[model samples]
Target chain A: MSEYIISLAGLTKKYGALTAVDRLDLSIRKGEVFGLLGPNGAGKSTTILMMLGLTEPTSGSVQVCGIDATMHPVEVKRKAGYLPDEVGFYEHRSGLENLLYTARLNRIPVQEATERAYLLLKRVGLYEVAHKKTRTYSRGMRQRLGLADVLIKNPEVIILDEPTLGIDPRGVREFLDLIVQLSREEKITVLLSSHHLHQVQQVCDRVGIFVGGRLLAEGDIPTLSEKLFAGEPYIIEAGVQPLPDTARLQTVLQDIEGIRSIQFSEGLFRIGCQRDLTSAIAGAIVRSGLALTHLQRKTYGLDDIYNRYFEGGPVYEQTA
Target chain B: MIFITATLKEDLSMNRLLNIVALLKAPPAATGRAPHPFRAIVDKEVSDHLRSWRFNILLVLILLTCFGSLYISVTNIGKAVKPDDPDGAFFFLKLFTASDGTLPPFHVLIGFLGPLLGISLGFDAINSEQNGGTLSRIMAQPIHRDYLINGKFVASLIVISVLFFALGFLVMGLGLIIIGVPPTAGEFLRIIFFILLNILYVAFWLNLSILFSVLLRQAATSALAGIAVWLFFTIFYQIIIKLVAKALMPSEMASGQAVLHYQELILNLFRIVPSQLFSDATTTLLMPSVRSLGPLTMEQVYGAIPSPLPLGQSLLIVWPQLTGLIASTVVCFALSYFSFMKREIRPR
Candidate 1:
């Protein structure tokens, strides 16, 4: 079998003039946590839907677990569990009842389904409210229930669309940590789609930066940064006590080896360079009779990468 | 792009072959998997309906209509029957058709309430799941998408059938206890046929509401659309047809054949209404004396003996109406099925 548990090749979905997913080619490895990070309406959900065969691609192929998704959707669905952005349950039924219904749909035996439902509920930290109606539960609890619901099928892959949307910060953290724990424990491939970059950055082993129906970049965090900032890799920031003049600081930082550009704005300095020049820049600042209050090398995060590609940078055009 | 197009063509042909192969495979029962996925859905829907307040209220209303009409029929049995009249011997069938001036007959009450019950049961069948954000979840399950729709239709049909049969038998039992006489075999068969007709009539509305549910996004909007169609067919359609017929009526100088043709034309136009078709079918089944639904000339009725027709003859007379009802129901269900399968599935 191929390494990929989910493979999408030239998958495109169009609604009249709007191309929701445009010639997308993505493949996720077995037991790997892959994040599809993009802004809202960036075709992440559409891509996930096609992977599970919930929505057919206008043109192209989707193979999940080595089965053609469009031709054999039921087989694909059997091996893949999906959690929608705002997952909801039957309001009148208890949380356990809701999960039981899903288990039955998967044709699990009554006794085994009930045992698994309870076990999953406890794992997701919803055991207390297992017997309560879902309507009375909060949004965070509902999301946790959704997590357990996805797990009930024992699927090979889990596709989550905006899983952390509208949850509290603490809930989001706990949810991400739980996801990481689950994936590691079960060796299950997870394709999580979200516009929340930092949340996905926390759990995903690899991420694909998507925008406008195209994947601009795909790799682990460090590799992605290296790709976007190929020419000048290191980014250093320094804060000066009693604020130095912009021109003076610029001249001093420019003289250092490997320093490409220096910009002093908002009482600090932002320096882009080829390599780590923290020591060199600090030495230059102190020798120039200026007290360096704060100095740290900037680590490229998903947010920074997103901004560089979208806000204003040549990376967007280059990647396109 | 050319490569993509080539691959796509190959994929389409492959999918067609796979579909044929799947069709040739063993059916679900023979496959011997845990309970069929379809059964689970149907079971869930059945319980949901049984527990819902909307269905309970409609059930109560239907029970009230049954008892109210029975009271009318029982109280007026003396006037409705004459000892010397053989045609009036059908006392059990009269229980459904007999009406006091204050209240309509049992069949007319069913005609009004049946559509409401069907609309209530099915108007929100799809859109409610969609709006509640549960549709995508269920769609993700390992089953054919059509199972959801089919299960809903079947569940509602089963519920309607059971309720109608129970009410029919209940009325018969009560009439038997009060009158101290069991209905003859013909009367019993006629009652069974009438209950079957009621179920079919309601099924037509249920399919209609389900179609609306598939086409519209909001439950309230679909409900209102179903109600609007129901109102039009039950009330305004006949009025409009009558007005059109009046304007095109033959003058007094016209031939007897022309007048007869005009009346037949008006009758045909009126039969377009589902309730009119239902009432015609029920009257033939329940009364057995309704020999013909269309206009008959004086010559055609000149030498005819007045007698109640057998069940087979009555069925033959209403065969076209039954076909019309069944065809319309099938057409509605097919439309809903195709539209649902064609539409994209997405969270709201």
Candidate 2:
């Protein structure tokens, strides 16, 4: 069997003159959480639709669970589950009834479907509201129910488009954690498409930074940061007391051999360099007889990498 | 580009053929030893309709009108029936068409209300699912997408058929108890055929509303469109047709043949309205004396015996209108089916 559970080869989708997904070539490994990160209208939802065979690509192909989606969509749909953005349910039906309907659509027997529905609802922490009409469900509760709905299929691959949209911050965190735990426990491959960087970073094993219908960069967090900052790969900031002579400090830090750039802002010196120079910088500061109040290395998060790729400008302080 | 599109068209047609073949086979879920997904969807839609206040309200309204007209027809039955009148044999059929002029006959009430029932049932069928965000979720299931639309249409048709048949049989039973006479086999068959024709007429409107639901995005917009079409056909279309007939009326010196042709033209123009077709067909079936829906010339009626037509003769007389109704219903359904298949399920 191929290691890839979901594959899209040169997939392109165009609406009139606009290309929604431009020659997207992506393959998701089995049992891995792959995040497709992009802002709204970056063709994330369009790509997901193509993967599920709900919308045809203008060109190229998609395969899910060893079946060509375009050629045999029903079979691919049978093996894969998809949670659309803002997933909706029959409002009049209870959560259990909704899930039971899905189970019936998947052809599960009524008794077994009921048992599975209850178990999944409980697993999603929605057992208390399992019998409540879905119209009464909150945004977060609906999202959890959506997760249960996807899981009820017992699919090998789950493609979630904006799965955590409109949930509270705490709810988003819990939902992401639940997703990670579930993917780990069930060994289900998940393709989560979201514009939210931190949320994607929390659960995604690998992420593809998408922009304007194209995947700009893709890798694990560290690898992507390393690639983005190949020349000067480290960022460090230090707060010093009893400010030393400016000329003396510049000469000393410039003499450290790998300093690329440095900036003094708000009583702290931010330094960009090629390698670890914490010890060297500390030694220089002590030699100058200035107290080193605070010193630390700054790790690159997805937001930083995204800004670097999109803006191609100086890095800014991380914003939550 | 042309070559690519041609190949794509070929592929699409081939895919459609395969879809049909697969639909003939068990649904994907059926492979897991479960019930057919189409049946499941049908069951869900059936229950939804049965529980909805809209359907219940419409049902109650129709029941009231049906029984009200039946009462009026029964009260006037003895006065209308003369001992020497040959139509005395058709006392049962009059239960539907007879009226005291306060309310219209049962068949007329249905003509006005049947379209409303169909419109209400189907106007929001697709658009509401799409708007509610349930459409994409359901489309992602293992069943063919066509199952959703087909199941809805079938479920609505079933409800309409059951309700109509029940009302028809109930009316017949009531008439039998009040009059103390059983309808002859001929009258029984004619009533049955009339009920079937009513279902067909309602199906025409149901499909038209479904087509609107597929074409329009908002449930409200589709509902309005369905109502607009119904209003035009029921009210404004007749007014316009009457104006045209008056403007084109034959001169005073025109020959009888000319008058006959002019009248036939007017009748044909009126038949364009679905309700007119339905009323004509039901009238011929329910009253069996309607020898011709077209204008009859003097020569045609000069030596003709005044007698109630046999069922076969009545059917033959209304065959054109019947075929027209059936054709239009099928056409509406086909349009909705194709457009729905071609539509994007994503909400904008």
Candidate 3:
């Protein structure tokens, strides 16, 4: 029942013969921390740009909060905040000055914009260097300043492309914390694209993995795990197993509905079942007089899903 | 009813917020009413230019050149009163001497200093902005693309006018110190008129520089193009006209008559280049000896290209050339603006 903040329906962008985004259909819910997980040149940035109305889509539609971005980009832009991967600013101006300039561009009153600029600078931990010219700022400081610039308008949706790309570990942690704070406190829907799988896994409530300019898989982490590893069995280890005949065990496990295969090695029996049938198979195993010592459910993480989908695979099934 | 209802439902709060945001987005007001965005862009451009050591040194060099030329005039006057060297005195009097055998008038220094100042101020206006990455940012603003070019053209004109006034004051101060006779009001007005005409001449270069800037993005390339254009009008343009006239005019005409005929042809051809027109206009204004040019007789010179025409007429006579310069500036600006707006801001 969540509100749909942004939607891209069959979005495709082509640069000459190369398709940057191919029929990308995505829906990000209001106030959710959504991650677009993809490697370099996977059309992640292109998709974000299209959503921002900064780049035109070759075909398809982008709607932000029910307003078509292509039809009314300025209106959509007013409602959304975007942080490009490589944020650039007028280097001669001070950090505060740059933010103030962006604020004015965003239409904040001068006095209030100044106050808000100071507050945002403080929030981003850039207050100490606010007076220093941007040319003097480091990459991490610049990124943080870029974030502060986006925050000035108090946008409904925040889109950050590679927000933590060049930051140190500590800076990344702070940046992620701020993103989480924005989503949780401000009720801001966030569509973050990053190559950092671990960070995305840590922060994103739901994620969409894109490979070759198409969404390969998408859902909540556990849901995506289940979807990707569907039909891959759970491994069950028993301590009291003297030995069960492999054929018999396979037969017994397979006799149960949804169990496709069972194999035993090193005092462990691996049972493959239809997704969501793990508990049923485990119950059947318990009833078969096997003392279950360990039970572990295996699911693919973002990295595994990324490699499986993007690297080599069944070529026909690959999204591209 | 439906349309009215839809319009009423349109989020006024959000629209108001956006308007407020737009206002807040402007750069800190440096001068005037936020300078129409293009002005800020042009101001930043001019400031960035004036920051360079080369331009600073150029300004210093100009100041030195003007004063140095003035000093030479003063010392020549001192040398002219040798009492024994009558021919030298006459030579000095003809060129450097005032009606009295004293310091040279302001026009003498202006004649030498004006073109140098005009050429120096305007030869790089557009090219430097393109090189500095300001053109793209300026064009990205909502203001019309032509504004940036026009604003730059206008800004450079203002800068040239200020420089002219500065030079004029310097010469006047020096003239007072050396000549010891304050200029009459008419003479002072004439000097001011000549300075203003020099500004128009500089505008031609500024406009031409902008045209080249749009035509070429590289600062060096635009600058080279501007200098080449200046050289063409100052030197090659006249030579070409002479050669063409000699080939076409009848052999029956006397040499002096042919020369006059060739001069008229060259002047007409030169008018196509705004800088040449500007120079011609200023020369007529500053030098009393240039009473008539080509088919224009002495009476015609007074009626058509007189020394002290009203400001409006002066502007009007050169209006076509000024319009050409202004139009060229606008066109260059429009091209740059359109190209920049359409260009993808992709990371290089």
Candidate 4:
């Protein structure tokens, strides 16, 4: 068996003169939770649709579970489930019935479909309202139901587009947790696309950063940061009481081997370093006779990486 | 002893199946076929249309047209039949399509009701799904796009066909109770054919409305376009056809052949309208005593028989009209299928 379960090769989609998704090659391993992060119109949805065989790609191929999605969409779909952004169920149907409807479309037997639907509904915390009409459910409940709906068929691969869009912070956290559980506990491969940086950071094992139909960066968050922000230095922030000693603090750290630059303002010293030097910096501050109020090493998060690329950093412009 | 043992085994298996169904929610159906993926779509669409306010309103409208026209037909059939024969042999059938002094025949009533009912069910069929953001979600399922739209159409057709058949039988049963005379086998067969054609006539409009639903992005615009086409066919078309016929006719029609030629042209023009097709088929089927609807010279009718025509003869006479309705319905459906397949499902 191939290591990757979902693969896209030279995938491109064009709507007349506008290319929605340019030539992109991507592959996700089995049981991996992959996140696709990009701004609106970055072609994330188009790419997801292409992956599901819902939209035809102009020049590319998508294979899910070793099945060519374009040639045999039904076979690909049988093993994969997709949850579109802003999930809408049949308003008149209850949550359970709606899932059953989807189950029926997958050609599952009626009796067995009913059982799985109820079990998944309970797992998603919607069992109590399973019989209630979907229209009456809150947006969060609907989103959770959407999760359960995709899981009804017990697909090997799940793709969710903008899963936390327009959701509250708490709901977003719960959804992210559910996604982690799906990948970690159930061993289901997941492909999640979202605008929420924190959600992607929290759930995804790997992420692809897209911009203007092009994949700018694709890897783990730290790897992307290291590669794209190579020239940029890590920051260690320290707060000291008695601001009169700021000059003394800078002179003590000036001769350190890996320390690149030092800036002091308002009793706060920010030391830029080539690597993690929290211990050495703390010792130097102690030696300089300054009481450390706050000492924290700030890692480069996905937000900083996104901003650097999105703001047209050197790497972004070079690729563009 | 054998029966008891067999029953026990069956009960255990049935319980096990139910348990799995409840627990799993969607075990594949135990059948040779792939469990017809479109079945659920059809069922959901059927239930949705049945429970919707729009469908209910259209149902009420059709019922009002049926019962109102039935009331008029019963009195008219009584007077139109021979005075000595208080009840005609084809009593139930005439009770359905006969006209009174006040109202047109039951066929005309259906002509007005069927298309509107079909349009109301289908005008927003596709676009409303898109507007609600459900189109993409449904498309995400294992089923193809063909199943979704075709299932919708099939569901609506099933509902409307059932409704029309029920109404037809209700009128027939009412007529039987009132006149106390059951229609002959021929009359029964003819009414069944009329009901089938009625379904086909409405199917044309259903396809037309679904086509609009596919072509137009807004629900309201598709609905308005459907109504506009319906209005053009029903009201304005005849006027235009009449004016065109008058202009094309000779200045002075001094001979019988001239009048016949003018009348043939007008009849051909009327045949183009779907409602005319429906009514023409219904008139031949329900009023079997009438041999022809076209103008004939005196010599041509000199030896014509007065007896009611046989069912086969009536069908042969209206075969062109029936084919026209079916052909147009298929044409509309083909157009809808083509556009829906070619359409990109993106929300743009």
lDDT of the candidates, in the order given: 0.87, 0.86, 0.65, 0.82
Model 1, A1-320: lDDT tens digits are: 49988888898999789998899888889999999998888898888888878788999999999999988989988879899999989999999999989988988776556666766776788877888999999999999999988888788888999999999999999998888888887787999998888998889999998988888899999999899888778878899877867677877666788877676656677788888899999999998888899898988899888897656654323210
Q: After aligning candidate 4 to the native by TM-score, how far in Å is the CA of B154 from where it should be?
A: 1.4
Candidates sorted by lDDT, best first: 1, 2, 4, 3
Model 2 per-residue lDDT tens digits across residues B304-328:
8767899999999889999999999
Better of 1 and 4 by lDDT: 1
What local lDDT does model 2 show for residue A104? 90
Chain B TM-score by candidate, in order shown: 0.90, 0.89, 0.64, 0.87
* Tens digits of per-residue lDDT for model 3, B257-306: 66666667666776676555555555544443343344654454565522
Q: Which candidate is the best by lDDT?
A: 1
Question: What ordering of candidates by TM-score runs from best to worst?
Answer: 1, 2, 4, 3
Q: Give the runs in model 2 whose Cα sits over 4 Å from its true position.
A: A238-256, A261-270, A279-294, A312-320, B1-33, B83-86
lDDT of 1 by residue, B1-348 (tens): 234224323533667545533432312122245688899999999999999999999999999989999999889876877776545868778888887678898998998999999899999999999999999999998999999999999999999999999999999999999888799999999899999999999999999999999999999999999999999988899889979998999999999889989999999998988899999999899877778999877888899877789999999999999999999999999999999998778976
> Model 4 Cα displacement at B202 (Å)?
1.2
Q: Judge candidate 1 against the unseen true structure and give its global Cα lDDT, from 0 to 1.
A: 0.87
Runs of candidate 1 exceeding 4 Å displacement: A241-248, A264-266, A286-291, A315-320, B1-33, B83-86
How does model 4 score on DockQ? 0.42
Per-residue accuracy of model 4 over A1-320 as CA lDDT, tens digit each: 49899989999999999998999989999999999999898999999888878878999899889998888877788788888888888788889888988888887776666666765776688977987999999888988999988888778899998988878999889888988886776678999998778889988999999988888889998898788767545878898765635457767776677766566645566676788889988888788787778898878888877877776644223210
How many Å off is the CA of B273 in candidate 3? 4.4
> Against the correct fold, how does model 2 do in TM-score?
0.90
Top candidate on DockQ is 4
Model 4 lDDT tens row, B160-242: 89998998898888888877788888888998898898898889999999999999999999989999999998889989998
